[model samples]
Target: MPEHEDKRPLAERIAADIRKKIMSGDWVPGLKVPTNEDLRGLYGTSNVTIQRALQILKDERFLDGQAGVGVFVRGQGSQTIMPAHYIAPAGPGQPYRWLSEATKRQQRSKYRMLKVAEVVPPVEVARALGLEAKSTAMLRSRIGFLDDQPAELVHSYYPVELAQGNRLADRRLIPGGTPALLEELGYPTRSQDDVVSARPATTEEYEALEIPRDVPVLEIFRIVYSDNDKPIEVTMLTKPSHRFKMGYHLEAS
Candidate 1:
């Protein structure tokens, strides 16, 4: 009997399957992977192929190898991020919601400002901010870290009229994140719209996230509206798909 042909290389396909298991919680952290012989038999592939697949996982920080024991899943697997939990402004003198959540997970977190400038944003972002053609906005870009690992890339845009000479355009970290700052600026968020999607990583995203080409990026395009449904901000967040899980909770009315 012949096998179905898959466009991706055999090793990549196998690695992808193993990655899914790890991300799905089926392959729990610190669990030993099947032996090379077992994997080869299960996948109906050669030992070299199995080794290649395992190597891919190792390179992606999903697996760790011991000299004599075996390869085991990393202690901390993919992290789940709840969008709702971090959307609101923090209380007075409180850390940003994201940083607080990371603390609860026992992970060190911080964000490094990448660039703050007034520039023409992406078409979607520009449109979301209600900007006209060829108009520019204040852009604040940064890389968020968890446990010292680059976890997400964030690019937020604000209307120049609202951000010029403001902390949003300043080259520094805004305490309590932009949500709190916006509230202080008299634009308390009244609502938000989020659109999540997965796509191939762009070159900048690939380099920024330090992920391989096989890993796609998950994008969260969020538009925050103030009073009267006026869109005041647009934030785009990018994360490695395999390393993050989006979580949401709902209550029956």
Candidate 2:
């Protein structure tokens, strides 16, 4: 075979094709997949090949099978997340925008505060927050859940000068998330820049998101700015790429 030839297993290739259709919205949620005979005919393969391909989709949660019935597309199709919706601070007595957004879609949402402490952040985060090499920053790590399933892992870092001796360093949950507290601390978020990328999940991410090894994770590195364009926060968000879609809307000036 040529160096550039497709070398993946036959079943995986078939599953990849089907997975692409599902992710591209060609196969909408709750739509029944074609019968085994239909699939075999379409691929000109054997029954075992079709079964193996279908099983792969089932494992990835793209399809669900019912005894004595056909397989249907899972209802929790890829969720499209609008970054703009999560940028604002929650209003008084209101839940965080992310939680509220999930509620609006009738999905239960919650967050688990995983860790809160002063620790040396990742090099990129350190640089973004203007911290000296090896300097410590306040780190707050959490996992966001939708309908009892882990949806995203978040690591947010704040400069020591800003978080020290403030509620930001507290281990407990903030009433309206960090943005509200930041605003109260006089660092109202003015704007933010986000860089998105896709990569294989790290060991910690794989365990946290409960995803298969084949699924990649999406990372959003965000730097939030305050007045005078000072960076107030640097956040890294990780989510299962196969289960989530990032949506952006830009208005013409």
Candidate 3:
């Protein structure tokens, strides 16, 4: 190959070359990429240029740098591109069932219903549930565990008309939980929309989930709707970001 001196910035050129190597499988997952020294010698560039190139790869989730260990390639197959703000879709069904299935299949956890009650909705919650302020509603909370380790916290709210006087609102109702209860009442679930984001956790959240303060939490806001387009429930789920990875497949719009 001819040594043509392209006018692009040194960092940009280095990043492009490294990307090509990855795409061509020259550097596979967990493989050590070229070090700063190696890059400096190969490209006849300064340390600054090499550092910038490495940073770019890291930001793209293609690489992870350990404190004492060198930078290693992160397999492309495990990469997540969603901004963590988009919600996952849940089909119509019992609210508890939808949550339980997601926890089992996606997060790999065992879910346990913590509490259920018939109570007046808070102002913000009432608005989301499309009910009058302070109107009665059903509230449910659950904790998910991965082999005894707490993994996620889930809180769900349902309209009083759909939840009150139902077996789902009974505190002693466990095991099959909400989904089964709803199905028994002839109100099978249909679909749900998930909204996710990342943020610092509150003290209560950190303690309840048993996570460190430095660990970021993934918050998912979900709205479960029925076949008639009626909002059945609104739920909030939280988990440690490092403990779980979110995935989605998209096509050209």
Model 3 lDDT on a 0 to 1 scale? 0.68
Instruction: Give the alpha-carbon lDDT of every model.
Output: 0.92, 0.92, 0.68
Task: Single out the weakest 10-residue window by summed lDDT for candidate 2.
Answer: 164-173
- Each candidate structure's TM-score, on Cα atoms with residue i matched to residue i, is 0.95, 0.96, 0.57
Candidate 3 residue runs with Cα over 4 Å from true position: 1-108, 173-175, 249-253
lDDT of 1 by residue, 22-79 (tens): 9899999999999999999999999999999999999899999999999999998998
Q: Write down the lDDT that model 2 would get.
A: 0.92
TM-score winner between candidates 1 and 3 = 1
Backbone clash numbers for all candidates listed: 0, 0, 11
Clashing pairs in 1: none
